[model samples]
Target chain A: MIRRRFALSPALLMSLALAGLLIVVVLDLPPQPGLAGPVAQAMDQAGVGHPVTAVLLNFRGYDTFLELAVLMLAVLSIWSLGRRDPIPARPVQGPVMHGTLRHLIPVAVVTGGYLVWVGSSDSGGAFQGGAVLGAAGVMLMLSLPREMPMPPALLQRLGLSLGVFAFLAVGTAGLLAGHGFMGYPPAWAYHLILGIELAAAVSIALTLVLLFLGGRSRKVRHDR
Target chain B: MTVDVISPQIYLLCGVLLFVLGLHALVVRRHLLLKILAVNIMGSGVFMLLLGVAARGEGGIDPVPHALVITGIVVAVSATAVALVLMLKVKAATGLARLPLSGPED
Candidate 1:
């Protein structure tokens, strides 16, 4: 299989040109206040701590939780697809591509880990990193030509559950932290965030890995 | 001198391009998976434009859009899953991947 990067020659030109024009428009236009200024301001007024993180977890957490469930449903849907069909023929050639994927898979896993580690401070996050890692797994699967690439159903389940389980389990840790229902007490805030991020990373990777598996039908054996 | 500036219309165009690309993919692609990918590519493009507009905020990135994108991402995947499952069932019944024929093979 070809390396997965999209060669956005025209897309690059278009995006840049559009971005440039927007620069001019934003300059001509008026400015507006931040959307969450009121809520954040109230937090400051009331002496609530770490309002940014608080807003992310408690105030707007229902959306986040639902997002996690959506990922779960994606996995389940893919899993069900596999059950209905026997398996897809691994028509993809493996021996030729094996060398390249073996080298790349570890690199992807590492990159994914780093993304999760620094997501809070940087652009990388569990979703991005996990997707990257999942790409590596897909690469590996593509390279292996279907003799026996997939791990057992149990492992698949673990991969699917890793993120939601991690996020919710830690969110529940709030009870122990004395912060009640999705609240992270001040003292363990860092640890809790870190844990949630790590778990999310695993979850996202698993989700991406499984996304490709979604509409695949059963493998048909053909005599050459 | 002052810093350089970007126009909001660029943001609008970005959203337009993304939506158009998605539309094109929906029309042109034969593969079930490729169409889904196109849909996501379109989503990312529109989302990028939205984020660009959000950049107009004073503090930094607008959390509201960020949150929305986060929400969108989840919803997108959920829809994707349902679509894929439907596709698979179609494939199982028909033995052919090309749609408009998700029916069973005789």
Candidate 2:
């Protein structure tokens, strides 16, 4: 088979031109303060010490809520495709993988918990922490034998919906209290934010694990 | 002038290059896995651009963009998962992991 010599295809040329234009444009962005000033001004009222967390969980809670919903929707779509294929069993050369998983899982749990907690005052949050936990779950799933049973369907469903449910509950409460949707009473802001983060973290982790699993498990009976 | 100084402009340029490279790959690559990876690279470029912009604030790095980027990352992950599952279904149904070429010359 004759391999075609490399040439500047139309696609390559177009992308190259586009890159040039974008590079020139991005080099001189307008000098502006951005939202940092506004975010700082409202930090006292936003409840969280960390600006990013305050923005995500308080000022822009609706976005986070919708993000969780999107994640759930992805899992739903995957389930609609078909039941999950069991993870293939690959023989380990030694107990290294299993031993590593046993040691790492505990550490991951602790780190994930710490990340969620520190998110209120630092550069960590539900997504970061949940990713760690999800990785741990994936490891667990990969190491398990083919006959190993997954968690109960009901329990899985609960975990998947926990984030969205918690966010909605908080938002509705705010609406009822006339603080507007997703608004926490200033006094309860910290607690509400923390509660939502914890729930979101759990949901995110479970959702990621499920996504990795690729579809619903057939072994677990689904009640109509 | 010594070229040792780093700035957000460097990040912006790199991001643009990455996005363009991904777009080029997406157009040329026939493999489903390459397409997915190209899309991810495109997303990373966008994320990088957002971060560069966030760093442009006078007082400090902007929080709103940071929040938006976080949201975007989650959305990207969700999209990639859906795409992967869809790819598998396509593979199972068609017995090919690559897209059919539209052009006859190849």
Candidate 3:
């Protein structure tokens, strides 16, 4: 009887070789020296104290606006494909999970709120805050029975679109004021950035939950 | 002599390896879900690489690239979510998790 030989696929071998070569080349390169840019000057003009947030929401607001639009577009396309029913009812969880969830959810909410507020001054920002809130939503969904009622569809839709709408409205206002689109006056910059971040956090959180749900549902049902 | 193990080159090398692995998986994997995951891994690699580059700047890490990577992360997540949804729809319609090797029948 002839036996078949097992060997690595040619493609896999080639890829591994390439990766090894890449590592060699990358290591040989000298350490890169830091380059100075307009960040220092821009930081002074940026409304927020956090340099990264200032760049995201002020210096490159246009990019952030488009990013939010892209997120909204993703949700729209998912919804258009078809509605998916919420997860089916599951057996009741033990008291341990129930107790944990009850405590966990409030902490998550407070932490998320703190992140959003702290974003103006430090490393935290809207996205981090939004992610925290989204996690909370996911946790709630898991803890509650499938039969639990969700918020009204209209409210859900508004939440999904809030970021994009807020972004556009602000940008358009800038255009009307002759500062170019998404451009903000120095005096109003801080307030405008904060407002936009607030709206964006809400939209991001809701959109994330909707994405996890996979599609729209007319109403969520409670398992009990 | 102490060699810095946590240098930017190490991070860059890791990113490169991850990117190649993802690319290989993308090319070889037949399952739609696996392909989607591979794409996400590739995206993460790019993010890592960008962050590594950002670390090289003089006074401190560049805020610009850090901001860009943060934006990229959200975009990547949104794109992945959409891709997963589309894959599910495809599965629902055809009852197949993997795409056909040949083009669709005319």
Model 1: per-residue Cα lDDT over A36-146, one tens digit each: 576555443222244444444455655666677788877676666564332355555556566777678888889988877666555666676777887887676555654
Clashing pairs in 2: none
Which digits, one per residue and each the tens of the lDDT, describe model 3 over residues A1-224?
A: 25345558886898899899888876676655543367776787787898888889988999999999988988888888788765765658888888999899999999988898899899888899999999999878877745456688899889988988998998899999998999998789988888888899999999898898888775434344
Instruction: Tell me each candidate's TM-score.
Output: 0.69, 0.94, 0.90
Candidate order by DockQ, decreasing, is 2, 3, 1
In the range B50-73, model 1's lDDT, one tens digit per residue, is 676667777654566775676687
**Candidate 2 per-residue lDDT over residues A112-191, each given as its tens digit:** 99999999999899999999999998888777544446678899999999999999999999999999999999999999
lDDT of 3 by residue, B36-104 (tens): 999989888888888887876666788888888998999999999999988988888899988788776
Q: Which candidate number has the best TM-score? A: 2
Please report the TM-score between candidate 1 and the true structure: 0.69
Best DockQ goes to which candidate?
2
Number of residue pairs clashing in candidate 1, backbone atoms closer than 3 angstroms, sequence gap of 3 or more or interchain: 15
> Which pairs in model 3 have colliding backbones?
A34-B57, A34-B58, A146-A221, A147-A221, A147-A222, A147-A223, A148-A221, A148-A222
Output the worst ten-in-a-row residue range by lDDT, candidate 3 chain A: A215-224
